[model samples]
Target: MQSLTNRQKRFLKSKAHHLNPIFQVGKQGVTDEMAKQINFALEARELIKVNVLRNADVDAKEAGELLQQKTGAELIQTIGHIVVLYKPSENEPTIQLP
Candidate 1:
C-alpha cells in the first residue's frame, strides 16, 4: 500500500477517534496470531485502535510499527498506550481517503 499523506492521516485520525481499541499488546508482544487477527480486523473495519498494556514488553510505538508491517496498515497515531491503525479493505472499502 502507498504511504498515507498528511491530509489522509488527519482524516483517518478523525475517523478513528470514536473507535475503541479492539486489541491489546502485553508481555507476549506482537505475536503472529495477533497480527493475523489485526489484519482481519483492519480488512473489516478499515480503521482500528490497539492498546498496549502497562506491563507490555514493548512500548506503544514499537508495537504499532510491528503491527503496521505485519498487517500492512498505516500507523495513523499513537497517544500514550493507544495505537491507531488504518487500511483500505480489499473486499469492500469503506473509509475514503482525502
Candidate 2:
C-alpha cells in the first residue's frame, strides 16, 4: 500500500471518531501477540484504534510504530494514549480512504 495523504488521514480520523480502541498496550508494550491481534482486527475492520495505557512500558508513539511495522498497518494518528491504524484488506477493503 502507498503512504496515506493528508486528506486520507483526516478522513480516517473522522471515520474512527466514535470507534472504541480494539486493543490495548500495557506494561508489556507492543508484544508480538498484541500485534497479531491488531493485524487480525485490521483485516476485519480496515481501520481500528488502539489504546496505550498510561502504565505501559513504552511511549504511545513507540508502541504505535512497533505495531505499524509488525502488522504492516499505517499509523493514522496518535492522540494522547490512543493510536489509530489502517490497513486495507487484500481481498476486501472496508475503508475507502479519500
Candidate 3:
C-alpha cells in the first residue's frame, strides 16, 4: 500500500467518522488471525475502524501501527481507543481517496 497524503487522510477520516469499530485488540494484542481477518475486511470495505479494549496489552496507537504493518493498511488516525485504517481493495474498491 502506498502512503496516503494529508488530503486523502482527511477525506478518509470523514468517511470513517460514521463507521464503528469492526475488530478489537485485547490482552493478546495483535494476532496473526486477527491481522488476516482485518486484511480481508479491508479488502471488502477499504476503510475500517479497530478498537483497542482497556484490557489490551498495547495502547491503541501501538496496536494500530502493528496492524498497519501486518495488514499493509494505512493507519488513518487513532482517536481515543478507536483506530481508523484504510486500504484500497485489490479487486474492486468501494472508497476512492481524493
Candidate 4:
C-alpha cells in the first residue's frame, strides 16, 4: 500500500471518526484468524478501526504493522489503543480521497 497524502489522511480520519472497532487484537496478538477477519472487513468496508486490548502481548503499533503486512492494508494511524486501516477497494471503491 502506498503512503497517504495529508489531504487523503485527513479525509480518511474524518470518515473513520464515527466508526467503531469491529476487529480486536487480543492477548494472542495478530493471529491468522484475526488477519482473515480483518481482510474480510476491509473488503467489505474499505476502512476499519481495530481495537488493541490492554492485555494484548503486542502494542497497538506492532499489531497495526502486523495486520498491514498480513492483509496488505494501509495503516492510517495508531491512536491510543485504536488501529485504523484503509485499503482502496479493488472493484467498487467508495472513498474518493483527495
Q: Which regions of candidate 4 are displaced past 4 Å?
A: none
TM-score of 1: 0.97
lDDT per residue, candidate 3, 1-98, as tens digits? 67888999999999999999999999999999999999999999999999999999999999999999999999999999999998999999888767
Indicate which candidate wins on lDDT: 3
How would you encode candidate 1's per-residue C-alpha lDDT over 51-91 as one tens digit per residue? 99999999999999999989899899999999999989999
Q: Put down candidate 4 lDDT per residue, 1-98, tens digits, no spaces.
A: 67889889888999999999998888899999889988888988999999999999999999999999999999988999999999988887888888
Two-way TM-score contest, 1 vs 4, winner: 1
lDDT ranking, best first: 3, 1, 4, 2
TM-score of 3: 0.97
Clashes of each: 0, 0, 0, 0
* Model 4 lDDT at residue 43: 84
Candidate 2 residue spans exceeding 4 A from truth: none
TM-score for candidate 2, please give it.
Answer: 0.96
Query: Deviation in angstroms for 85 in model 4?
Result: 0.2
Give every collision pair in model 1: none
Each candidate's TM vs. the true structure? 0.97, 0.96, 0.97, 0.95
- Cα RMSD, model 4: 0.9
